[model samples]
Target chain A: MIGIVDHGMGNLMSVRNAFEYIGAEAKVCREPGELAGADLLVLPGVGAFGDCMRNLRHRNFVAALDEMVIGSGIPILGICLGMQAMAKRSFEGGEHEGLGWLDADVVRIRPAGREYRVPHIGWNDVTFEGNNPLFADLPADPVFYFVHSYHVQCRNSGDLAATCDYGGTVTAAVRKGNIFGTQFHPEKSQDQGLRILENFVRQGGQC
Target chain B: MLKKRLIPKLQMKKSRFGNRMVLVTTVRFDEVMEIGDPVSQAKIYQAQAADELVFLDLDASVENREPVTDYIRRAAEELFMPLTAGGGVKTLDHFRMLLENGADKVSINTAAVENPELITRAYEAFGAQCVVVAIDYRQDADGREKVWIRGGRTGTGLDPAEWAEKAERLGAGEILLTSIDRDGTREGLDLETTRRVADAVTIPVITSGGCGLACHFSEGFLTGKADAVSAGTYFCFKDENPMQTRSQIRNAGIPIRIQT
Candidate 1:
């Protein structure tokens, strides 16, 4: 079963609904303790990075999630702001400490030129850097829905899994061992996204 | 590369049965014509590789906030495309209710004009990406663009370009600009107003209302500089879908998504 951890930034109904649509059993767990039975945890979020981190901390999910996910070796997939929350820190709305899983920081998107918009919204294609199971059986350079101003900049080059060309090369997906993250919302990216979520769900069981 | 989107708009109203929401088509932004069930049409769009799906409830009023929440939940449970729902949304509570139900974005038309502050509140509550201010406008006798509200029944003395700039300043992530003059006429899109609004706002603008030919969508992108093109009557009445339409756009040297 998949556990969708809610941190109270916005509605996560679509996350749970997307999972159930793919013939997977998923539950919306408000508390960390409620996720005990979940083999894999899916951290879904929207809104600002600092606020999402605070909500996770306030819900007492930070420490418990560290213990449950890292200690127990269970896989976790972070989407959008949830993905940014996995980084070490963020510069959005002042500095805020993240869950500190990946060696990265979230900062505002400064397009190389002024022609590109701040919020890189809509379907942009992704380029897979290395062979990873998270994007298995997908088409070459598949497009996914993206809506964000801040993206992850990894200090460790090995952590980079996929990147997309916007105004510049923007980090689109990342994976390191049991921890995985995607800047795009797979739940809203149509069939390619559903296939991605399914890959995560299946590969999560093996881990 | 962010390709231009070909959106299929699902204009909705309560069925004559008054129980289920059905797909609708509009002319001049007032006359409603029932097409079919939303789910069936959505599935067809999904098969046809539609870039996204838009659901607007035409019958929603301030007193009777009949949003397409139930249908949205049902579609969200079945389909995987992004859903943008709006119409008669007047308060932040209504915005929260729709997002919680299954809508990816809540569009405010009447409220965005009546109470512009609601845009900030909704933006603060749910990010600007969730707040899409849909501006319905028609030309006056003096050839001035007047913003129309309550599904074009009430008119406000606000220019589409200026109102769009204000909406963006108030934290609107995007603007859905519809031209009531050429709606359902199949003449062409209102490139003049669309270009004006697109140049006014930094955010993405989706031009709608007049699209009889697939090449018109190309014109919106190449000439009007619109980020996306949304149409209800063309897709509902014409024998075209996103696939054939996108093919025309691709053949016209316009960058559109290569369907998977």
Candidate 2:
């Protein structure tokens, strides 16, 4: 079973609906026991980074999730802000600790120059860098929906699976063994985004 | 590079005393507007390959009402992509409220032309990234297209080209030009009118009204010189045939959100 972690921060409906749409049995669970029973876990979020982490920790989900996924090595997928929370820390407020699943930090995307739009809101192509089960059948540059101001800066550059150019080279997708993350929204990204989720599901939580 | 956007516009109408009126005018919808829930309809559009979603509260203008807070809040909470809300936007507060509710942008029509000052006010308040000027127009006796105000009933007497230039100068990031003659007709985009206004300004121009076939979208971008094309009927008729239209556009190589 695919369990979507719901802590009242991220968008849970669309994510649940997407998994259900793909003919996969998924449940949005706030309880740690429900999460432990699932074969794969999905951590979905929207809103501020600090608030999401606070909710995860306050609800005792952070520890439970770490025990189930990182401790036992259960396959996990994090989308958008959920992915950001997997990093070491986020600069959204001051210095907020993250899940520390990946050796990365969340930093604001520098505007680079004048007339550069922040919160890069729209479609951008994803270019895969390594062979991964998540991107198995997808094209080299499949369009994905993105709406973010801050981006992930991987502590280990080799862990990066895909990258996209916004104002400059921005991390689009990351994979470190069983832990995976995407800055763009696959639920909102139509076919390309759905295909990515479909590929992830097809892997049977094995990464 | 940005792809040409295809939007499906839904107008918000409310009935007071059982008289259904357009959100922007006192005149009633011919058959009383039955506004489909914006959240559900927007998701339907997203599923049917709509590039973006636009909602205009038609009754807001006639009733001295602002953009419906509950509607905008619900829409912003549910919609996945950038949402553009129109109608009853008269000041910066209205724009801020809509944005705060989850609107990616606000479309201003009569207020920008009538008050004029509201244009820069919204531009400064929300920045050019979130402001879109909606120009409803029709051809005059001299065959020159003229802008319309007050729900496409009252004539503004402003030339389309000049009005577009003024809007761009006022810090509008984009323009939605709807040809009244072609509205609901589905003939094709008014290429000459679209080209004229598109050439008059540097901001992206979204051509509305008269999108019958996939070719119309391609022509709107290539021939009409429009940056985006929007249609309502083609998408709303989901029971009959929706994929046919999407496939045709895709076969034509027009950039749109592909449904897999």
Candidate 3:
């Protein structure tokens, strides 16, 4: 079973609906104990980075996620703010510590010039950096729905899986071993987004 | 690069023939004409991989009824793209209910205008990404662009460009700008007004109303500089769907995501 970690932050329903649409047996796991049977985990989130971390801590999900993702090597994927929360820290709404799963930090996206808009809300293309199971069989460059002001900046360039040009080259997708995250909304990206989600589910077993 | 979005604007109302939900279009926000069923048309757009879908509940606010959440839920089940539901969004609970029922975004027009603070509250609660402030605007007899509320029946005398700036400052993630003068006219969008509002705000602007042909969409993006273009009567009454429209727009040299 694919367990979607629900700490009361993300659009869990849409994520669950997407998984179900693709014939994946996924459930919203609110309690940490509910994630015991799942081989793959999806950490979905939205809203502020500080509030999200506070909620995770309030629900005691930090330690549980660390065990499943780091200790036991269970593969996990984070979406939007969920992806941002995987970084070491974020400056959104003041400095906030993240899961520290990947060697990256979340910072507000800066517009290159007057032509670019903040929040970067729209469908943008994701250009893959290197081979990763999460993007297997997908388009060379797939467009995904993005709605955020901050983006993840990877410390190690090798961990970067894909990048999208908003103002400049912005990190779109990241993958380091069993952990994966996307700055865009795969569930809302139509066929391209579904393909990415489907690929993630297909890779669940191998991980 | 972010591809320009081609969105189908479906106006919802009780079918004149029966109780089933149907698609409708209005001229100057009146003279409603039933065209087809929203669910079937939405599925067709979904199959064509339209960038997004916007459903405006025409009767919700005017009739003082809740948004057609059931229709939204039904459509969301089959459609995988981003769904934006608008009209009659009065409170944060309305926003919550819609998001919970499968809408990716909730757009408020009249409520957001009457109580601007609602935008801030909703944005603070759900994050700025999910809140959309839709503005219905038309030039008055004196030729001043003014914002309209309550299904465009009441003119607020507010400058659309200024209101768009305020909405963005209030944390609205997007602005859905509809031109009342061009709605259902098929003359093309009010490019001048659209350009003005789009230029005034930093957030993405979706221009709706007065979309006659596929070329109008390209004009909205290329000339009007809108982030997205929404069509109502053009897609409803004409022989064009999102597929044909997208083809025409893509042929105009704007990159759009083609569904394989």
Off by over 4 Å in 2: A111-116, A205-207, B12-48, B54-260
TM-score order of candidates, top first: 1, 3, 2
Reference-based TM-score, model 1: 0.97
TM-score of each: 0.97, 0.64, 0.96
Chain A TM per prediction = 0.97, 0.96, 0.97
Which of candidates 1 and 2 is the stronger one according to TM-score? 1
Model 3 residue B160 CA deviation (Å) reads 0.3
Per-residue alpha-carbon lDDT of model 3 for B59-139, expressed as tens digits? Answer: 778788776677788887778878899889999889888887788889999999889999999988888888889999898
lDDT of 3: 0.87
List, residue by residue over A1-207, the lDDT tens digit for candidate 3: 999988876577788888999999998988898988898999888778988998899989999999889998888989999999999999997899999988888998997887687878888888898888788777666778888989999999999989999879999999999999999998888777888898888767674
TM-score of predicted chain B, candidate 1: 0.96
Residue lDDT tens for model 1, B194-247: 999989988889899889999899999989999999998888865887888999
DockQ, per model, reads: 0.68, 0.10, 0.65
Ranking by lDDT: 3, 1, 2
